[model samples]
Target chain A: MAIINYANKEVQFKIVFYGPALCGKTTNLAYIHSQITETNKGELVSLATAADRTLFFDFLPLNAIVIRNFKTKFQLYTVPGQVIYNATRQLVLRSVDAVVFVADSQWDKMEENIESFRNLDENLARQGLSLDTIPYVIQLNKRDMPNVAPIHYLDFILNDRAVCVPSFEASATTGQGVFDTLNTVSRMLLVKFARDAEAAAYVKSQPTPAASPMDGVAAGLRQPQAAR
Target chain B: MQSTPIVTIAAAEKFLKTLEEFLNHSEAFFALIIDRGGTILSQSGRPPDGTDITILAALAAGSFAATRELATRVGESEFNALYQQGSHFHILMNAVDDDTMLVTIFSTQTTVGLVRFYSARTSEQIAIQMQELRADCVDAPLVFTEADLNTASQIFRDTTDKAV
Candidate 1:
């Protein structure tokens, strides 16, 4: 519910990073903030420290080119990676417009990564939103590590759960593929924004107001119907 | 809710000229800038009327006030944005720079394709003006006083209480 006004116009969108501990979620943001011109990004503020980790969240405001005179912006955040931070992660997922799950591509952390992914599904389900309903992407980081779990195995688990989503591979330490990953997911999210606007218009053009927020805003865009 | 009362004559003339130019360039059907209390500072659009805004603002203010209390109780130092959508309208509020609110009513003609782009510019512009207005408001601002409340209550009693 944060209202952002820029250029006398306002555009609001949110992106959340989800993944296991040390999966390079923060690193991706550090790289993006560094790579882009500072003018395009505001101060990267991290909230209080909880035992030396992100206590609440990290917020970075990034501006996109204006369309039709309305400005577009994204608030990027990363959930604390420790398993103990489950409640905080769920809070971050609330009202998220897009998600980028950073996976640790090493053999040792395979189980941790898989469990984190499952946690994401459960959390989203509780909110009545699914990964499928919102724009979601995955990044398999630490590819340079030796004996990393095979991408195929990772794919099998994800696809097997019908959790298929846009994904990439990279070594976050080396800053590879991170920006490209964010850019793609952001573009997809914008497209979803367009779709939502259309749904809003159609809903209003109706002869009468819909019975509920669920009926009006759901738009059948994110909710997977049985047909699929 | 009735459309916002034509702002004070001085405020109305000034806002109308500037906002007309703004609307022409941006092409948003209707826009409003209100204080946190939901008082209409200045507006440009086919807002219903003053009487409507009186009730609408009360409802919106009640919602904001309740949410503020909710946030405080939960130890949330700050309140986030607020929005209410109906069949023909989308009501959006963002706390810009901790003062004034940027509220807009969008019709079907406004597109997501175009809204973000225009809204950002408008937000920034409104933010600056609102800061100044908030300052002036502190000095000698309009307030919905207890007397106004008593008057309203008596009128309601006269209208509904009489009927009852």
Candidate 2:
């Protein structure tokens, strides 16, 4: 869920980078963390194993942009992509506003990418969400590799949806397309917020019961954020 | 399904101030309001320079999430409260709402019972303010104008330039 805290004049949105194991999800975060100045970014926290595989998730809180006097913050998270970490993946997906589906572009890893995407759908469905509803972007990572599949083929497989969402060709380690992915997702979130606010305004203008100031923190929010 | 809580800077400052005063009066050492994702919404009281609230929030959220899972398996709907008793100080965590939590750290001078009692009340008040802010936000216009978009675009563009 996007946290638009009027009390603090700040808006925070949670963006999760998700993909199969070793698809460069953590690399995406590390690259962005290194690029952001210390003043605008929090310390990057990674819960990983001795071999450096993520055990739980990686978190990096970034605050730089200000929209209409409201400080905009993005809490970027990368779930442990290993198949065994599916439970943790579902946990991390809770309340997510946007997602970056990082797919390994190597031809041999195509199965892993497809399986992960299917798992993503299943996990989201468990939470009553669908890819069709949430604003997301696809990142075809490891594009610089020799064995990578063509962008068009990847798009045909992943982007052939009701709507073909924005997809980026990235080499996360070398920093290619990292910021482009971030920038596009952030803009998409902002646009979505604007549209939702307009709908909320219409609802607010109607004659409804005077809502209990304290009620519906979860129930009322479920409507706007969960709407497809 | 609800919109994110929209907190004005002044309101946030005011709430922090109020929380600071409350902590002092309650004899607590620190207070932190964290969102469900474990992001520090606001914090009060003196913290050591090395205190990383981000990690703390993330861990706390993770702990709560794990504990809640345990609760469900044990036939409980959810665990709304958590307490950890340390050697010198005690910690208390109370759910402010479905998506928010209040964490209090205090010395042994203040008993857990007192902290719990006070924190419960404080959480209620905070929830009211937060929900009201959310309610008021419906009328709050999106003032993100063309200039703001350009500025944002330029800011990201600068970052993109660096990354490239």
Best-matching candidate per lDDT: 2
> Model 2: what is its DockQ?
0.38
In candidate 2, residue A26 scores what lDDT?
96
Model 1 agreement with the true structure over B13-130: per-residue lDDT tens digits:
5555555655566555666665443444556777644324433432354355456656877899657566566776666554544534555556566654354455566666666654
The local lDDT score (0 to 100) that residue A67 gets in candidate 2 is 77
For candidate 1, write residues A1-228 as lDDT tens digits.
222232245455668888888888887777666666655676665654655476545666676655555555666878788898776676666556788989998888888988998998898887677877878888888888888888887766554545577778877667677766777677677666566545645565678645886765677877677874
Please report the candidate that would top DockQ against the real structure. Answer: 2
DockQ of all candidate complexes: 0.02, 0.38
Indicate the residue-level lDDT of A135 in model 1: 84
Q: Residue B31, candidate 1: how far off, in angstroms?
A: 21
Q: Over all chains combined, what TM-score does candidate 2 have?
A: 0.84
